[model samples]
Target: DVKVTQSSRYLVKRTGEKVFLECVQDMDHENMFWYRQDPGLGLRLIYFSYDVKMKEKGDIPEGYSVSREKKERFSLILESASTNQTSMYLCASSFGGRPGYTFGSGTRLTVV
Candidate 1:
């Protein structure tokens, strides 16, 4: 099994609905992040947490929120799903300020 796991591999949501993407890490990493990938836009950071209950906004945090109530769990919340938000979401974790991240198999979300 992968060290980092995302709750869903694929999801479909209606516009204006709330959506939650869950990710869990088994390695006890100190940093966890959420990113969205598009056809040519590449990976854009949406949110991140360095420790439990601590979160920071990343490059594309607008329309997205995050929760890190526990060390092993990090959740990304889309308050209102939109077609513009449809993309592949990635969850990653790292420890000791390492440059590399262990990523979960991405979640493909489609908003209609």
Candidate 2:
């Protein structure tokens, strides 16, 4: 089975601090995505990378960025974490957009 792993299951950060969330997929999928899910908001894409060193901004990319230096690995960076950024961050991957999307367990972040 394909599996996506996130670095943290829960995180607490203060406002104005940089945050890093790591993700790795064992399937070596070509597409990796970062999304933040909130109550009543569903899943909103933050960024996605189709290949190494290439990325595309998704629906909500402000204050967030991503890196894909190697296959099977992707990272999300919050330049300056904020209270509004406190949400459940999810990492997902797909094999050439087939088989739909496989998501990580998610990182529940709280900013105070």
lDDT of each: 0.95, 0.94
Q: For residues 1-112, could you state the per-residue lDDT of candidate 2 as single tens digits?
A: 7699999999999999999999999987999999999999999999998899999999999999888989999999999999999999999999885868999999999989
Candidate 1: deviation at residue 11, Å? 0.2
Distance from true location, Cα of 100 in model 1, Å: 1.0
- TM-scores for all candidates: the values are 0.97, 0.96
Off by over 4 Å in 1: none
For residues 1-112, write the lDDT of model 1, one tens digit per residue: 5499999999999999999999999998999999999998999999999999999999999999999999999999999999999999999999957889999999999999
The candidate maximizing lDDT is 1
The lDDT of model 1 is: 0.95
> In candidate 2, which residue ranges exceed 4 Å CA deviation?
97-99
Q: Please give the TM-score that candidate 1 achieves against the real structure.
A: 0.97
By summed lDDT, the worst window of 10 consecutive residues in model 2 runs over 93-102
Residue 13 alpha-carbon offset, candidate 1, angstroms: 0.4
